[model samples]
Structures are given as C-alpha cells and as structure tokens.
Target: MRLKGNLSQIKNSRDNQNVDVELYIDKIEYITNKKDGRYTQPFEFVDELDTPLVLTGDCLARVQDKHLEEGEFAYQVYDKVEGEYVLNPDKYLELTVAYDFDADLTILTAAYYTVTVSNEEFKDIKAERSKEKKQKKGKGRKGRS
Candidate 1:
C-alpha cells in the first residue's frame, strides 16, 4: 500500500525528552495498492507505527480529480484501476496519517477515521502536538518536499 498526503495536524510526542517521538497528523490525498493493482485489500501497520491500524481499501472508487462531476471534493482512498487515483462512490475510507522518522518518512502510519470521530478527537489530539512542534521547531527535524 502506498499513500500520498499532507501533514495536516500533529499530536506531538508523548515523551518530551526524545525529540524523535513526535506526531505528524496527515490527510490522505491519494492511496493505492501496487501489489493488487485492481483489487482493494486491507493494509496492516502493526509492525510499523506507534499506533497500529488496519484499513479497508475501496477498489471501485473512480474520480478524475478532487473536483467531482457535481462540485469540488477532496476524495481520499483512491483506487488505481487502469490509470490512477480514483474512488468508488459507495466504498468509504478515512485515514489519519503520521510518520516514522526512523525511516525518514519513507514509512508512515494511517489510523482509520470517521467524520464523527474526527470532530471531537482532533481537538484533543492537536493540542498535544502544538507544544511539541513549538519546542522542537528549530531542533533536528528536516523539511520534506
């Protein structure tokens, strides 16, 4: 499974002494399974991140871009059938992404999310990240393009 997204928020690290322990919140802009190609499959990150999760991919979701036929929409969990980055209308997926600094962001973890859960949970989690980001702003963290 390969995911492309932006770091939308953060929870910071629970441990302050260790700068490596920091949270990077993300919004998944594009997702694909290189192995399956056509069929959507579950991706497990149990061995990869501080928070482990399983995601159900939507294989039929197809869209031209974020803008739908109706209006603008940022579609997540896109299935690459013949071309790339498409979404199945009925099929649903939401991911809250984070980083694995050890791998220099080569590895990432995405926790499953729902609209209801995010509204309440995001406020609590984002607060934690604010402090850490400020404290370590000019420390050792490198920028990514």
Candidate 2:
C-alpha cells in the first residue's frame, strides 16, 4: 500500500514530551506483515551499503491544530551506538507523525549525501584547517580604524 499526505506540525502523541514538526508523507511502501501483527517497512541508508532496514511503529500522533491545511513532518536521522546518538554520515530513516483532520498517519522520507574522499583524506583536511586557524590568530588587521 502507498500512502501520501501532508501533515500539520504538532505535538507527538506517542511521546508527548517532544513537539512534532509538520511534514509531508511523500511515499510509504508497505513491505510485509509480521506474525506479531506489525507491518514491515523498508528504510534505506545511503552509506550503510546493507539491505534496507525494516521498521515498524505507530507513526500516528495527536495534534492540537484543527484547521484543514497541508503541511510537512519534521524529521532527523541519527545513528545510535552504545546508547549514544551521533549524526549519521550517510542516509537514515525516521518515522514521523502527520495529521489530517481527525486521522493520524506515517510518512517516509529518504536523505542522502555523496562522499568522494576517504577517511585519511578527511584527517588531512582537518589538519590543514587547524593550521589555518593558528595562522589567522596571530595576524590582525594592522590599519583598523
């Protein structure tokens, strides 16, 4: 099943402690039905190079806004490792809440980036930046009025 819609930003009902942002459910492709009764959905991360990650959750969240309008869901991807969250260098998936009238829904979005350099190259780049910062610290505008 494919579902698409725009949701007004509001507070997330599943977790009321956090505020939900408005976002669009561009496309949602249903993968399979699990024996536990949850649906499997594919989520791909560009850098992982592994198969798409399957996710299942109740994306529907309650919102206070009632006016009929179209909006988008706010989302951010993170890599959780050893109980610490870090910004993923590649693509990641995040299920977000969206509301339409009295109905709640889920939206899937994919983010990606191209990295041409290797890890060693990145280290050299950082070293150059540190060197440049040191150089600039000792040099100031001599004729500043």
User: Of the candidates shown, which would achieve the greatest lDDT relative to the real structure?
Assistant: 2
Off by over 4 Å in 2: 1-69, 92-145
Best by TM-score: 2
State every prediction's TM-score relative to the real structure. 0.23, 0.25
lDDT (Cα, tens digit) per residue for candidate 1, span 1-36: 334332222122111222222223233222222236
Q: How many clashing pairs in candidate 2?
A: 7
Worst 10 residues of 1 by lDDT: 9-18
User: Distance from true position, residue 128, model 2, in Å?
Assistant: 38
lDDT of 2 by residue, 10-38 (tens): 23433322223323323322222223447
Error of 1 at 19 (Å): 34
- The alpha-carbon lDDT assigned to residue 65 of candidate 1 equals 52
TM-score of 1: 0.23
